[model samples]
Target: MSSDPLDDVFNLEDRFYTQGYTQGVEDGARAGRIEGRSFGMEKGFEKFLESGRLAGKAIVWANRLPKKTAKQKDASEKSSEACTLPPLPSNPRLEKNVKLAYALVEPDTLSTDNSDEAVQDFDDRVKRAQGKVKIIERMLN
Candidate 1:
């Protein structure tokens, strides 16, 4: 009756705007939850695949190598050389003395030896050591 059209118009617009804002906020929250769940699922699946691949690789490595005694493995790692178990022969005598010569060629364990004989002995031991390693390598392939 007073012709306060401006007040009515402002009030109606404000109500509409508030309703629109509330709807927008609810829609955004739902969308964010969906995106977050999707991302989490993807990461979990990726980790599962990576772990499966590693397990498979470990199986392959275990199959290729014989069941080495802990002592042999430890000794090999300590000596910085590959330790391998040869095939079991019907006659133990037929098997060559695989560990015939011993000398510390490992740079860490090498002792000071001034004599020529010691040097020659060390060289021959290394050669025999290398031959044994070669035999093991050939069997692996």
Candidate 2:
């Protein structure tokens, strides 16, 4: 077997090109994976920030509610001691208005019908009755 010096150099260029191509593909995949991970982490951080803000607001509101309710209870107790509760009147208008308001605001009335049309009808009735109550309240005031 005669060894030619030029035979070894013949496929060296093809091998180098193939190796370079494989390395480029691997680098591109690595970059893609890194970018994807970064994007996912960014989304997770945003959700965390939003939830943290909502939790902070909820805590602030929850903390203030007890103080306000306590003040209201104290005021009511003082007023009640000073003046006895007025006897409930047997007025027909008061009864009718209260019954109408109760019917409009009741969960059972609104939720009884599962159909969309029935729900719309219930909503319309509730709104109409609410308007009437507002008018009656204004007249009383």
Per-candidate TM-scores read 0.43, 0.36
Tens digit of per-residue lDDT, candidate 2, span 1-141: 588888869989999999999999999999999999899678646544543443343333222222236777687566556654342344556445545555554544544344778656755765665565565455445
Q: What does the lDDT come to for candidate 2?
A: 0.56
RMSD of each: 19.6, 14.9
lDDT of each: 0.50, 0.56
Error of 1 at 90 (Å): 22
The most accurate candidate by TM-score is 1
lDDT of 2 at 141: 59
Off by over 4 Å in 2: 1-16, 66-141
Clashing pairs in 1: none
Error of 1 at 97 (Å): 29
